[model samples]
Target: MRTTDTLNVIAANSRVLVGPLVLLVVLLLLFVFALRVGIGQIISLSKKVAESKVEEQVLSQKLEILKTSEESALPLADLSLVAIPSENPALIVISQLKNLAGEKGVGLSNIEAKQTAAVASIFHTEIEVTVEGEMGSLFDFLKGLGSISPLLTLDQVIIRQESGIAKVDALIFGNFAPLPTTLPSITSPLDELTAEEKDILAKISSYSQPVFTEVTPSGPFERVDLFNF
Candidate 1:
């Protein structure tokens, strides 16, 4: 009887232990599944971080390129401005006049410059000017101004005699075109006349001499044989 009782108690303990062992096995499997899911999420986050870094690098490179382009373009724009004649049409006209007239002993007084449509459709602008000078000097000056590379015109001429001196007034026009055939790049006028521009001015110095030289007396007229009025 005692041996049977001991066997029954051992059987009951084994049944209880079987249920606990099955529950432990199920819990361990759930924990392993959760660990695997967490690892997958970590891998996905790492991939996103890598892709973001690549995007960041691409944006940085683009920004650097933009900066470099802006830096280099400034000088190129300046160069283009110099190469275009239309940028400052008035400047070319004034400069050419000053240079040419100065060389020819013709003083510029009451100069009037205006912009008009260019003679050729290809040019951006044409300058028209009204200038005053001595008649002999102006004739020579006109001939020289015409000798400019692109060509200049003596549009109109008016003459008046003032105390035996001939006063000349003329309107000159010209279209300054830049070489190397490019779209008009500059939008402003010429900054100042260049040395090359001054060379062409020598032409203004030439004048047609009158038949007789005029002599003027300062204070009073005297019966002088050597000098006469």
Candidate 2:
């Protein structure tokens, strides 16, 4: 009878311990999961910080270059824009051609200038020029075209020795690059101008730009707005 009582008490104690043991197991699992999540976040953040340090080094070099080259950059940029203008170069090209003809002692017999239509590449226009003069004068005029600005290129030329005339087909290039919508990333690589690029800049800088005459509109001489006047 005593043995049976002892067994019954032991069974009751075990039943009571079951709930606490299960609760402890659940708490342990939650603690482990929390630790894993915290470790993962810490590793990700550490990696980002390391990458940022490298980017910072690269950016520092670029900053130094910008500081040192600011003076030269402006003039080169201006020359580049003039070399490949952002607007229609038709008028300036025609003016240069006419001026060049006179300077080279050639008479402009017939001139036709047209902007290229939006067929494939609309970044250029075309001009047809006919000059009449001696062979030497025409040769000088042809040679001078490359030295003038608005970036003119003679694509086709036909010369008639007997008639003392030359028909020239030329292309005038323009730059219509759109402004950037977003700033570049800090990690973006900064490259110095290569030898070829520097050579191109030098050639472009040497090209002579046409003198533009701005026509200012005159106000009404008789004063149309009498009350205001």
Candidate 3:
């Protein structure tokens, strides 16, 4: 009878401990699962951070490129203002000359334009102008032409005084650049000006102005015949 009683007591103790052991096991499994989920979230966040860093670096590089482009654009804009387009260069020259002559109280008698041979990717256009004005006004007009756009070069000048008025025949040359099909590659923005370009600009600025001011024309001047040769 005592053995049977001891066996019953031991069995009852085992039943009580069984529930607590199962609960501990469940808690341990849940902790393991939560730890695994946390680890996965950390890894995903790390990957995102790395990708963001890479994108930030790429954006920085793009910003630098934009800065360089901005700097380069300024000089190119200045150059384009003086560069001649591939359009009707003769009309442009004639109009510019007529306006300049009228401003300086000069009379434009005739103008003739001829296209010369291309040299070094640049096309040359020759303009022959016959002008009559006072000697001082004629000199001033010639000087002002040097400072004008599309860059004129006075190849020859013949001047004679007729009845106290100067009659001048000038052979001027202008250049036009052909339109480029392919875009040029520019690596840096801080490029130096070429020697030839510097020299040309210097010459243009070195022209002397006349001591006295000539009266500008009040009305439109007489139109001169423009012939293409």
lDDT tens readout by residue for model 3, 27-111: 9999999999999999999999997787777666656755765654434544553446564466667777887887899899879
**Model 2 spans with C-alpha error above 4 angstroms:** 115-123, 161-186, 213-229
- Each model's TM-score? 0.36, 0.75, 0.51
What is residue 82's positional error in candidate 1, in angstroms?
A: 9.2
Report, for every candidate in turn, its global Cα lDDT versus the true structure: 0.59, 0.74, 0.74
On residues 1-229, what C-alpha lDDT tens digit does candidate 1 reach at each position? 8999999999999998999899999999999999999999999999999977877776666566557655544334433333334443555556667777777887677666665555454344344444455777868876776543234566677777767666666666555555555553232222333455433333322221112237875866457786654
Q: The CA-based lDDT of model 1 is what? A: 0.59
Model 2 per-residue lDDT tens digits across residues 61-134:
89887776676554687777677776667788888888888898888855676766443433667777777787
* Model 3 misplaced stretches (Cα beyond 4 Å): 1-82, 184-229
RMSD in angstroms between candidate 3 and the native structure over all alpha carbons: 13.8
What is the Å distance of residue 87 in model 2 from its true position?
4.6
- TM-score attained by model 3: 0.51
Rank list by TM-score? 2, 3, 1
